[model samples]
Target: MAIKITGFYQLPHQTMPELVDFDEVFDTSFMRKYTRFRTFEKFLQGSRLKIENQRDFEALPEEKMDAWVRKATKFSSWQEMLDTATDKYVMHKNM
Candidate 1:
C-alpha cells in the first residue's frame, strides 16, 4: 500500500515554514491518541475561524490565529502546540 503524509514545522528562530513527511500510521495513531481533532484540518476548523485551506489559514493574522489556538486547544501558543506535538510524536516513536 502507498501512503502519503505531510505536516509543517517551524523552529523558534526560523522565518520559513518547513514541510515534513510523517509515517501515515504513526501520524494517524498520534492524532487519535493526543488530540481532540482527527486531523489537522479538523483542528483548524475547531478554531471556528472559517479556515477552508492552508492559504485561508495562513492569511489569518498571527495574533488572531494564536488567540484562536489558545482558546481551542490547551496550548497557550502555536509554538507550544507544535512543541508538544513533536515531543509526543518522538516519544511514541521510541516506544
Candidate 2:
C-alpha cells in the first residue's frame, strides 16, 4: 500500500522569511502617504502594515501602492489576502 500526505501541514520554521527592519530601510516620505503620519520617525515605530489606512494607500502612485500590497501580502501574517482573486470578492464574503 502507498501512503499519501495531504490536508493541512505546519511548515518548518526555517522556511519562513526573516522580519524586515522597517526603521533601516522603509522610505518615510513614501510611507507617510499611507497615513496622517504625525512624524516620519514616529510612524516607523508605530505603524503596522496590516493596519494601514486604505484610502491613504490608494492616494499613492500605482508603483507605490503595488509595493505596499506586496509588502503587506508577502510579509504580514495576513498573507492569505494575497491568495484571493479580488478586493470585491473579499468584501462580498465579509458582508
Candidate 3:
C-alpha cells in the first residue's frame, strides 16, 4: 500500500519526463488544455527539471535541443535549418 501511494503521488511528475522541448507541453492540449503548461511551469519553479539556470539550459547542444523541439512542434522546414535553429536556441535561449 505504501508503494502504491508513493507511485500515485509521482504519477503526474512522471507523465512526460522526457520532455526536452517546451512545445511538447502543447501536445496534450486535447486532453487538458494549458494543464500541461501549468504543470511544466510548476516544475520549472520548483527546479525539478534543471531549468533554474539560463546558462545551464544554454549548455545543451543545439542539435540535441532541436531534435526534441522538432518532435514537439509542427513546424515545416528543412531539417538542416531546423537543426541549426535548435542549436541557436540552446545557446541563446530563443524559440
Identify the leading candidate in terms of TM-score: 1
lDDT of 1: 0.62
Give the range of the ten consecutive residues with the poorest summed lDDT in model 1.
1-10
TM-score preference between candidates 2 and 3, better one: 3
The prediction achieving the highest lDDT against the true structure is 1
Candidate 2 residue lDDT tens string, 1-95: 11121122122333554332333222343345434443334542243333244344334365543554555333222223222322333343346
Candidate 1 lDDT over 5-90, as tens digits, reads 45675544469866765443236555566557676656665777766655565677878877976776666877676667776665
Candidate 1 wrongly placed segments (more than 4 Å) = 1-18, 21-35, 90-95
Q: Per-prediction TM-score, please?
A: 0.56, 0.23, 0.29
The stretch of ten residues in a row with the least summed lDDT in candidate 3 is 1-10
- Model 3 clash pairs? 62-87
**What are the per-model C-alpha RMSD values against the true structure?**
6.2, 18.0, 15.8
lDDT, each prediction: 0.62, 0.35, 0.36
Best-to-worst lDDT order? 1, 3, 2
